[model samples]
Target chain A: MAKTPIAFSLNGMERSMFVDPGQNLLDALRRGVGDLSPKYGCAQGTCGTCSVLVDGKLQLACITLAEAVAGSSVTTTAGLADGSELHPLQRSFMDNFAAQCGYCTPGMLMAAKALLDRNPSPQRQDVVEAISGNLCRCTGYEPIIDAILKAAAFMRTRGRP
Target chain B: MALHRGRGFACVNYPIGMNLGGDPSQALVHSTPDGKFMVTLSSIDLGQGMKSVTRQIAAETLGVPVSDVYVDTADSDTGPHCMGSFASRGTHRVGNAVIRAATEARTQMLQAAAEELEVDAADLETDGEGGIRVRGAPQRTISVADVAVAAQFKQGRTLSGRGIFLVPPSEVDPETGEMSPVTCFAHAAMAVEVEVDDETGMVRVIEINSAYEVGRALNPKLVEQQLVGGAWMGLSHALYETTEPYYPDRDHLPVDFNTYLMPGPGDVAPHNIAVLERPAEDAPFGGKGPGEMCANPVLPAVANAVFDAVGVRCDDLPITPEKILRGLRANGS
Candidate 1:
C-alpha cells in the first residue's frame, strides 16, 4: 500500500507522521501516535465518538483522511484537560453525571466544547443541537444538557476564558 | 426487554445501549459551604442513578443514615457509568461505587481521627459527617466538619474517591443476536392500556403503567424518572424505533430528533405511577436501574394493550397504522 506523509498540530505539538492510504485521522491518532481518547465506535460516521476539533471546527476524525490535516490543528478529548484537573464541561459532567459508558465522551466533549468555545452561554436548545450527533445511552441526554448548561454557567462565572 | 419464548430457558442479558468501556466520574470529594460533598456514582447515572447513588454513598460515608446526602449524576467524566446499558444495575454498580468511595472517606476520617488522638485507627467509629465521638468517652468528640477540614492538611491530598466497575451487567450478545447469555437478571414487568382507532387505524397512546424489581430505591424519585425515560425509549424501539439504518449507506436516516421518531409528550401517555419492587441482593440502600427496563416492555405492553383493545395480536414491532391494519386483517376483524 502506498503511504502518504501527513503533518498536523496535535494537543499543541507540531509533528509529522506517515499514514497509510486507508487510515483515517482517528486511526492514525489511536494507532500511530498512541492517542486512545477517540474510540472506534460504529466507524460509520454516525456515532460522534470519533469527533475532533479540526482547525477549531468539530469534525469526525474517523472519516477525515490523515493527509488532509496537513498544517491543520487537531484536538482530542485528552487535550481538553490540564493534567488531572478537568475542563469545565468535563468537571460538570462529573457534577451532573452527563456521560455513561463514556465511549461517546471524546466526541461529546469535543462537540460541546467547540460549541461552548464559540458561544460561551448557549441556551438549552443550543446545547441539544450541539450534541445531536453524539449518542449517549447512559444519561438519557438530560444530565448532558444540564452539564452543558452548568458548564456555561461556570464559564460565565469564570468570565469564559 | 427480552422475552423467553420457551419454558425453563434460563437467561442472562446485558442492556443493548450501554457500552461498558469509557470513563465518567462517579465520586466527588470536596468541602461544601456547610459540609463536604462526598458523592458515589454508579456506572452511568444516565438519568437513572445519577442522584440516587450520590445520596446513598453520602449518607453511608457521613453516617447521616442516607437522609442528608444529595447526589447529582449530572456529569460523566469524573463519574463512572455502569458496564452496560440496561438501567437494571443502577443499584448494584453505583452501590458498589458508593461503598468504595464512601468507605474510602470513612477510613480516611477514622484514620485521621486516630492520628490526632494517638490511638489505633481500628478503635474509632464514624458517624457520617465526621461525627466521631470517642468510642467510650462521653466528652471526646470530633465533628465531621472538623475532620474534613483537618484531612486536607493531614492526608496531603484531596480525599476524593473513585471506583471503576464493569459488572458485565446482563450480557446480550449483539454479535450473535443472543439475549440472556449471562447469570444476572434485573427483571421488570410492565403493563399498559391503549386505545386503537379502527377507521383511521391510528393508535393514540392512552396511558401506561409499569412495575420493575429495582432491588432497592436509593432515591425513589429518580427511579420514577428512569421508568418514565425508559418507557419512552422502549416505546420508540417497540413501535417507532428502527434498528435499520436509514438509506445512504452511512447517513443515519434518523439524523435528528424529529426524524428519529422518538416520543414527545403528546405522543406519550401519562407514565402511570410505576411501582419499584426492592430486591434483596442489590446494594447498601437497595437500588437498581429503572430507565432502560421501563422501555423494554413498552412496545410489547402497547401491542398487548392494543390486542386487548382491538382484539389483534401483532407479531411485528411499531404497531403503526399499517401494522395495526395488518393486525386487524390477520385477526379477521
Candidate 2:
C-alpha cells in the first residue's frame, strides 16, 4: 500500500505523517504520530474508547479515515491537560474516582470534553446521553456521570484555568 | 398487553479465595535512602485497584503515610511470586504478604534509628509521620530519612524484607466428604425490582437495594467502586450479555461491543448500597477483597423478579425476551 501524506494540527501542534491509504485515524495517530492517548479497544467503533475530536467535534478515530482529518485540528485526551495543571474534567474525574483500569478514560474524557464544549451546564440525563457511546466496564458509570456534572459546574464558574 | 411490576430478594455467602492447592502470594518491601518505601509484587491489578489496596496495606503496616509508599507490580522476573489475581484473592492474600514484608522492613528501620539515637530498638516507635522517636521521650526523635541515610551509608545495612502467604489445602474427610477450603467468606443480600412487559417481553430493572459484608474495607473508595462496577456486570450478565444468541449453534456469535449485548449507561438503575464490616479473624486489617462477589446476588435476584412478574422461570443466563415470550405463549397467556 502506498503511503498518503496527511497534515493536521494535533494538540495545538502542526504535525505531518504518512499513513497507508484507508488507514483509520487511530492507527495513524498511534503508529504514525506517536500519540498513544486514544486506545484501540474495539476497532469496530462500537466501544468509544477510540474517541477523538476533529475540529472540536466528537469523532471516532477507529472508524474515521486519516485522510479525512487533513488540515483539521484534532484533539485527544493528551491535549486536555495544560502542562502540569489538569483540566477541570481531569481533576473532577480524579476527585470523584471516575476511572478504574483506565482503558476507557481517554474516550470518556474526550466524550465529556465534547459535551462540556457544547453544553456548559449539562443535566444528569444530558451527561448520560453524551457519553452513551463510550463503554466503561468499571465505575458503573455513576461516578463518571457525577464527575462530568461536577466539571461542568467548575468550568462554568472557574472559566477553565 | 400490560406491564407487570414485581420485586425479589436473594442472598449469597461467597468464599474469599480459590480452594486450589496452596493459593499463595509473595511480596517484597524495601526503603530508599530518601525514606520512600516500595512494595514489589507479581499480582496484577486488572482494574480492581489491587495496587492501590496493597500500597495502603503496606503503608499502614510500616507506620508511614500512604503517600510515602509506592506499589510496583513487577513482572515474574523481577518481582516475588504470586498466584495471579483472581477469585477475590488479591486483597486478602497479597495484603497479608505485604503486611509481613513491611513489618519486617519497619523493624529494621527502627533498629537503625535506635542505633543512631543510642537507644534500645524496643524503645523506638514510628510516629506515622516519617519520624522515629523514643516511646517515652518525644524529644528523642529522628526522621526516617535520616535513619535510612545512616543505615545505607554508615551502617551498610539494606532496609528490605520479603514475605509470602499460603493457605494450605484443606483436608477432606473421606467418609463425611467435608472440608474447610476457605478461611473466610464475604456475604451479600440484594433486593431487585423490575417491570415486565407482556407485549414485548422486555424486562426493565427499576432499582436495586443491597448490602455487602466484605469483612472490612481497607480503602472504602476502592471497595465502593468495585461493588458498584461489579453489580453492573451482574446486571449485564443477567439480562443482556450472551456469547451464544442462537443457542446450541456455533453461528451468529457477537464479535464486537455492538453485536454483544450489554447494559448501557441509560440502562443503569438506581443502586442503593450499605457496606457492613465484620472484621475477619485472619484477614489483613480484617479486610477481605470485594472484587468478585458483588455480582453474585444480582443474577438470581433478577431471575426471581422476572418469575414474580410474569410467573416464568429463566434458568439460563441473560433471560432474553425470546425465552420469556416462549414461556408466556406456553402458559397460554
Candidate 3:
C-alpha cells in the first residue's frame, strides 16, 4: 500500500507526514511526530491508554485512522503543560499523588481534561462517568477523582482553560 | 425478587524477602569532590519509589541531608548485583546494603576530616550538613568537600564503600518439615460487604475495610498506594478476571483486554485502610516490605462474602454471574 500525505495540528504546531493507510493515529503521533506520552496499553482501544483529543473530542488513537482525520487539531498530555510550568491538572495530580506506576497517567489526564473542558464544575458522578473509559490499576480511582476535582477548583481560581 | 447483603472477613500473613538459596543485594557508595554522595545498586524501581527510599536510608546513615544523596539504579550490568525487584524484598534487602555501605563511607569521611583538623577520629562528629566538627568545639569544623579532596589527593585514601546483604540459609529438619524461611512477616486483615441480587445473580461490593501491620512504613504514601492497588488486584482475582474461559479445557481464551475483563472506575468501592507499624527486630530500619501482601487477604474475603450472600460456596477462581446463578439454582434458593 502507498503512503498517504496527511497534515494536522498537534500540540499547537502544524505537522505533515506520509503515513501508511492502515496506520492508526497512535502510530502517527508516537512514531511520526515523536510524541511518546500517549502509550500503547492494549492497542485495541480497551485500556484507553492511547486517548487523545481530536477536534476537541475524546477518541482512542489506536482505533482512529490517520487518514480519516486529515486536517484536525490533536491534543496530548505532552501539550497539557506550558513550557516548564505544569498545568493545573498535572499539579493537582502530583499534589494528590494520583499516579502510581504512571502507565495510565497520560490517558487519565486527557480524559479528565476533556471532562473539565465540557463542564468546568462537574459533580463527582460526572467525573466518574467521564473517566469511565480509562482504566487505572493503581490509586483505586479515589485519588484520581480527587485530583480532577481539585484541579477544577484550581483552574477556576487561576482563570485557566 | 430480593437483594441479600452479606459480610465476610479474612486475615493473612506473608514473608518479606526471598529465603531460598541466599538472596543477596549489593550496593556501592562513593562521594564526589563536591561532598555529594552517589549510591549505585542493581535494584529496579518498578515505579515503587525504590530510589527515593534507598536515598533516604543512605543519607540518614551518612549523617547528610537527603538532597545530598543520589541513587543510581541504572542497570544490573553496570552496578552491583541485586536479585531483582520482586517478593517485596527491594526495600528490606537493598536498604540494608545501602546502610552498610553508607556507614563505611561515613567512617572514611570522618577519618579524613580528623586528619585535616589534626584531631582524633573518635572526637569528630558529623553535623548532618556535610560538615565534620570536633566534639565540644562548635567553631572547629571542616567541610566534607575539603575532606574528600584531602582524602583523595593528599592521603591517597578512596572515599568509597561497598556492602552486600545475604540471608543465611536455614537448616530444615527433614522429619518435622519445619523451618524458618524468612526473617520477618507482614500481616493483614480485610472485611468485605457485598449485595447479591438473586434474580440476576449479580454481586456488587459495597465497601472494603482492611488493616495491615507492616513492619514499618519507610514512606507512608508508597505503602498506601501498594495497599490500595493490591486490594484492587485481589478484587479482580476474586470476581472479574480470568485467563481461561472454560477450565480444564482451554477454549475461547481472551487474547486482549476487551475479552479479558478488569474492574473499571465505576466498579470501585469505598475502601478504608488502617496501617499498623510493628517494627521488625531484624529488618533494616524495622521495615518489613508490604508490596505483595496487599492482594492476599482480598481473595479469601471476597470469596467468603459471596458464600455468605447466597449461602453457596464458590471454590472456583472467579465467582462470575453464571457461577452464582448456577449455584443459586442448585441450592434451590
Candidate 4:
C-alpha cells in the first residue's frame, strides 16, 4: 500500500504527515504526529481509549481512517491543558479523584469535553450518556460523573471555555 | 407481569501476601544532595497507587515531607528485586521493605546532622519538615540539604539504605496438613439487593452495602476506588461477562469488548462502603492491603441475590437472562 499525505490541525497547530493507506487516525496521530496522549487500547474501537475530537465531533481514532478526516481539526487530552494551567475538567477530575489507573482518562476527558462543549450545563444522566462509550475499569464511574458535573459548575462560574 | 425484589449477603477472607517460595520485596532508599530522597523498587504500580503509598511510607519513616520522597518503579533491570505486584501484596510487602530502608537512611542522616552540629546523634531529632534540630532546642536546627552536603563531601558518608522483606517459610505439619500460608488476611462482607423481572428473567442490581477490614488504609481514597472498581468487576462477572458460552467447544469466542460483555456506567448501582481498621502486627504501617479483596465478596453476593429474587441457584458464571429464564421455566413460575 502506498502512503498518502494527510494534513490536519492538531491542538491548534497545523501538521502534515505521510500515512499508510490502511492506517487509522490513531496510528497517524501517535506514530506520525507523535501525539501519545490518545492511547492505543483495544484498537478495535470498543474501549474508547482512542477517542478524539474531529471537527468538533466525537470520533474514535482507531476506526477512523487517516485519509478520511484529512484537513480536519483534531483535539486530544493533551490539548485540554493550556500551558501550566489545567482545564476545569482536568482539575475537577484530580480534585474528585476520578481516575485511578489513568489509562481511561484521555477518552473520558474527550467524551466529557464533547458533552460540555455542546451543553454548558448538563444533567447527571446527560453526563452518563455522553461517556457511555468509554469504559473505565477504575473509580467505578461515580467519581468520573461527579468530576464532570463539578467541572461544568466550575466552567459555568468562570464564564469561560 | 410481576417483578420480585430480593437481598443477599456474602463474606470473604483473603490473605495479604502469599508465602509461596518465600515472598520477598526489596527496596533501596538513598538521599540526594538537595535533601530529596529516592526509593527504587521493582514492584509495579499497576494503577493501584503503589508508588504513592510507598512514597508516603518512606517519607513518614524518614521524617520528611511526602513530596520530598520520589518513588521510582520503572523496571526490574535497574531497581532491586521484588516478587512483582499481585495478590494485593504491593502495599504490604513493598511498603515494609521501604520502611526498613528509609529508617536506616534516616538514622544515617541524623548521624550526619549530629556531626555537622557537633552534638550527640541521640540528642538530635527530625522535625518532619526537612530539618534536624536539637531535642530540647527547636531553634537550633540544621537543614537536611546542608547535612546531605556535609555527609557526602566532608564526612565521606554515603546516606543510603537497602532492605528486603520476606515472610519466613512455615513448614506444613505432615500429619495435620496445616500451615500458615500468609502473614495476614483482609476480610470483607457485602450485601446486595436486586430486582428480577419474572417474564423477562432480567436481573438488575439496585444497591450494594459493603464493609472491609483492610488492616489500615494508607490512602483512604485509593482504597475506596479499588473497592468500587472491584465490586463493579464482580457485578460484571456475575450478570454480564462471559468468555465461554459453550464450554468444551470454542465457538463464538468474543474478540472485542462489544462481544465480550462488561458492565457500563448504566449498570452501576448505588454502593455504600464502610472501611474498618484492624491493624496487622507484622505488616507495614499495620496495612494488610485491600487491593484484590474488594472483588472477592461481590461475586457470591450477586449470585445469592439472584437466587433470592428468582428462587434459582445459578451455579455457573454470568447468570445471563437466558440462564434465568431456563431456571424460571424449571421452577414452573
Candidate 5:
C-alpha cells in the first residue's frame, strides 16, 4: 500500500511519519513515530489501552485514523513526565501501588489525566466512572482508584502539572 | 418481588507448590567486583512479585542490605532450571532456592573478608550495611566492596554459588490410594454479603471480609495485592465471567475483552482483608506463597450468599441470572 504522510505534535515535539492507508493512530505512533506509551489492548475500541489525548480530548488511538489527527496535538503516558520529574499521577500510582502487571497503565493513566484535566476535584464515583472503560486485571481497581484520587488532591492543592 | 440482602461464609485450606513428581527451582547467586549481588533464576514473575520477594530472600540470607541484591529473571533459557510459575510455587520453591544460593555466596563473601581482616571466617559477620566485621569487635571491620576487590584481584577467587530446591514426589499406595502431596497448607476464611433482586434475578456483591493464614507474609503489601485482586477474580468467576456462556451448544463464544465478560471497576465491592502468619517450619523465611488460594473461598461464599438471599442453590459456575430465575420459578416463589 502507498503511504500517506502526516504531521502532528506529539508530547510537545513535532513528528512526521509516513503511514499506510487506514493505519490507526496507535500503529502510527508506535511504529512510525516511535512513541510506545499508547498500548494496544483491544483494537476494537473496547479496552482503553490505546487511549490518547488528541487535541486535548480523550480518543481511542486504535480506532482513530492517523490522518484524522494530522495537525492536532496528541499526548500519551510517555509524555506525562517532564525530563526527570514525574507527573503527579505517576508518583501517586507508584505511592499507591496502582499497577501490578502494568499492561493497562498507560491507558488507565490517560483516562485519569483526562478526568483530572476536566474536573480537578472529582468524587470517588467520578474516579470510578473515569476509568470504567479501561480494564486492569491485577490491582482489583481499588488501588488505581485510590491513586487517581490522591493525584487529584495533590494537583488541586499544588496546581496541575 | 424485592431486593434481599444476605451473608454467607466459606473457608479453604490450599496446598503450596505442585504435587507432581519432584517440582524443582534453581538459582545462581554471584557478586560483582563492587560487592553488589545478582541472583539469576529461570522463574518468571507473572505480576506476582517473584523478583521482589526473591531479592529480599537473597539479601536476608546473605546478611546484606536489600538494595545490594538484584534479582535478574532475564529468561528461562539463559538462567537456571525452574518448573515455571504455576500452582503458586514461584515464591515458595524459588525463594528456598535463592536462600540456599545466597547462603553459599555469603560464606564465600565472609571468607574473602576474613582473608583481608586476618580473622577466622566463622568470626567474621556481615554488618547488614555493606560491611564485614569481627563478630565481637565492630572496630575491626572491612567494607564488602574492598573485600570483593581483594578477593578478585589479590586472591583470584570467584565469589559465586549455585542452589536448587526440589520437593520430592510422594508415592501413592496401590491399595489405599493415599499420599502426601504438599509440604504445607495456607488457610483462609471469607464472608461475603450480597443483594439479590428477586424480580431480575440479579446478584450484586456488596462487601467482602476475609482472613488468610499465609505462613508469614514476606512482603505484606504484595500479599495484600494478591488477596484483594484474588477476591475480585473470585467475584468475577462467581457472577460475571464465562468464556462459553451457552454450554453444550458451542456458539457465541467470546473472542475479545468486550465479549468476554469480567467485573468492571464499577462492579467492585469493599473488600477487607486480615492476614495471619503462623510461619511454616519448612517455608523459606517461614513464608508461603499467597497467589492461588486467595480466590478459592470466594467461589463457595458467593454461592452460599446467593442461596441465603433468594433460596436458590447455584451449584454451577457464573451463577447467571437465567439460572437464578429458573430456580426461583421452580420454587414457585
Candidate 6:
C-alpha cells in the first residue's frame, strides 16, 4: 500500500509522517512516532484503550483513519504528564491505585481529560457517564471515581479551570 | 499449601499432557529437594499482582528478601506438576505450596546462618532482602541468596519441592452427579440498580454494590483492581458484549475499534459502588478470588435491577434493550 503523508501535532510537537492506507492512527502513532501510551487492548475500540484527542475531541485511534485527523492536533497519554511530574488525574490515579496493569490508563486518562475539559466540576453521575465506555477490569469504579473527584479538588485548588 | 483450581474437591494436582482448554496462564517458582522448597504453581499473573504477592508469601516464609524469592512457571518437560494459574486460585492453592517450599529453603538458610553466626536457628528472623539475623545482632546475619548460591545451584543439591493438590472428585455418586474432596468453597454477592427507559427499554446500571470472600487480600490494591475490573466486565456483559450477528460469519462480527457497541464514558452508571472483602481461612493469603466473582453476578444483577425499575426478569446473558422490549411485549407491558 502506498503511504500517505499526514500532518498532525502529537502531544505538543507538530509533526508529519507517511502512513499506510490500512494504518489507523493508533498504529501510526505507536509504530511511527514511538508513542506507547495509547495501547491496543481491544482493537475494536470497545475497550477504550486506544483513545486519543483529535482536535481536542476524544476519538478512538485504532479505528480512526490517519487521514481523518490531518492537520489536527492529537494528544496522547504520554503528553499529559510534565516529564516526571504527573497530571492531577494521573497523580490521583496512582494515589488511589485506579490503574492496574496500566494497559488501559492512557485511554481512560484521555477520556477523563476530555470530560473534565468539558465539565471540570462534573457531578459523580456525570463522571460515570463520561467514563462509562472505558472498561477497566482491575479497579472497580469506586477508586477511579474517588481519584477523579480528588483530582477535581486538586485541579480546582491549582486554578485549572 | 498447594494451589489448586476449580470449586474445590476437583483441583487437579498434576499437569496434563496437553494444555487444558488453551489456558494461557502458568505457575512460576523454584524449589529444592529434601522437602525444603515447594514450587506450587506457575507465575501466570492475571493482572491481579498476585505474582508479586506470591513472592512476598515465599520470601516471608523463606526469610528471604521479596526480591531474593524468584518465581517461575513449572516446566511441563521436567518440573513439578500442578495445575497452572487461572480460575483465580493462585494465592489460595499456589501460595501455600510456595510458602511450604520457601519455608524449607528458609530453614536451611536459617540453620546455616545460625551455625555461622553462633545463634540458635529460632533466634534469627528472616528479612525481605533474603538475609537473616539475630534480633539485636546486626553482625550475626546470613543472606539466603548467598546460601542458595552456595547450597543449591552451585553444589548441585536437588532444589526440588513438589505441590500436587487436585480438587477432590466429589464423593457423590457419579451416576447421581455427586462429587467430592470438596477442597474449599468461595462465595460472592452483588447488588445493582439499573434505570430502564420506558420508551427505549434501554437498561443503564445506575449503581452496584459488591462483596466477595477472598481467601485473603494478598495485595489489597491489586484485589481492589480486580473488583473494579470485574464490575466493568459485568457491566459490559450486561449491556454491550454480545456474540450474535457476526457469529456464524466470524468475519462479519464486530471487528476493530469502530464497529463494536461497547459501553463508554457515555454508558456507565453515575453513582454508588460498595466493595467489601471477606477473608478466607483456607486460602494462603486469606483472600478468595474476586476476578470472576464480580462478573458472574453482573448479568443477573443488571437484569434484576432493570426488572426492579421496569418489572422484567431477563433470562439472557446481555439484557439488551431488545430483550427487555421482548420481555415487555410478551408480558404486554
lDDT of each: 0.65, 0.92, 0.89, 0.90, 0.91, 0.66
The interface RMSD value for candidate 4 stands at: 1.1
Candidate 6: where is the Cα deviation over 4 Å? A1-24, A41-47, A53-60, A63-75, A79-87, A113-142, A155-161, B1-43, B64-85, B115-122, B127-131, B135-139, B142-177, B245-260, B270-281, B302-311
- Chain B superposition TM-score per model: 0.70, 0.98, 0.94, 0.97, 0.97, 0.75
Cα-based TM-score, every candidate: 0.57, 0.98, 0.93, 0.97, 0.97, 0.72
What clash count goes with each model? 48, 0, 0, 0, 0, 66
Best model per DockQ: 2
Regarding lDDT, does 2 or 4 come out ahead?
Answer: 2
lDDT of 1 by residue, A39-87 (tens): 8876768778899999999988888888889899989998999888889
How far in Å is the alpha carbon of A37 misplaced in model 2?
0.9
Docking class of 4: medium
Mind giving the per-residue lDDT tens digits that candidate 6 earns over A120-156?
7879877787777687756555677778888988898
Candidate 4 per-residue lDDT, tens place, B1-333, comes to 889998989999998888787899999999998889999998998777899899999999999999899999959999999998888899999999999999899999999998989899899988888899999988889998899999999999978899899989988999998998988889999999999998898888999999999988888988888888888878888888878877767898787888998888877899999999998989888987787878878888988998898898998888888889999999997
True contacts kept of each: 0.06, 0.69, 0.57, 0.59, 0.57, 0.63
Of candidate 3 chain B, the 10-residue stretch with the lowest lDDT total is: B282-291
Q: Which ten residues in a row have the lowest lDDT in candidate 4 chain B?
A: B240-249
lDDT tens readout by residue for model 1, B1-333: 111111111112234123344212244444443335546343444445555555755676556555446665545555455444343544555555666676666666677666666677777776554477677773677766666666676655444555544434455577987654322355666666666677656766666655566566556655655666666677667667654443235565555444555543235466565464655553545544454556666766777777777766767766667776776678776
Give DockQ per model, in order: 0.06, 0.81, 0.63, 0.72, 0.74, 0.40
Candidate 3, residue A24: how far the Cα is off, in Å = 2.2
Candidate 5 backbone collisions, by pair: none
Model 5 earns a TM-score of 0.97
**Model 4 whole-model lDDT (C-alpha atoms):** 0.90
**lDDT by residue for model 2 over A1-161, one digit each (tens)?**
88888899999999998888889999999998899999998898889999999999999999999999999999999999999989999999999989999999999999999999988988999999999999999878998999999999989998873
- Measured with C-alpha atoms, the lDDT of residue A90 in candidate 5 is 96
Q: Write the per-residue lDDT of candidate 3 for residues B39-110, one digit (tens) a residue.
A: 999899876778888998899899889989999995988899999898888889999999899989999998
Q: Least lDDT summed over 10 consecutive residues: which range in candidate 6 chain B?
A: B3-12
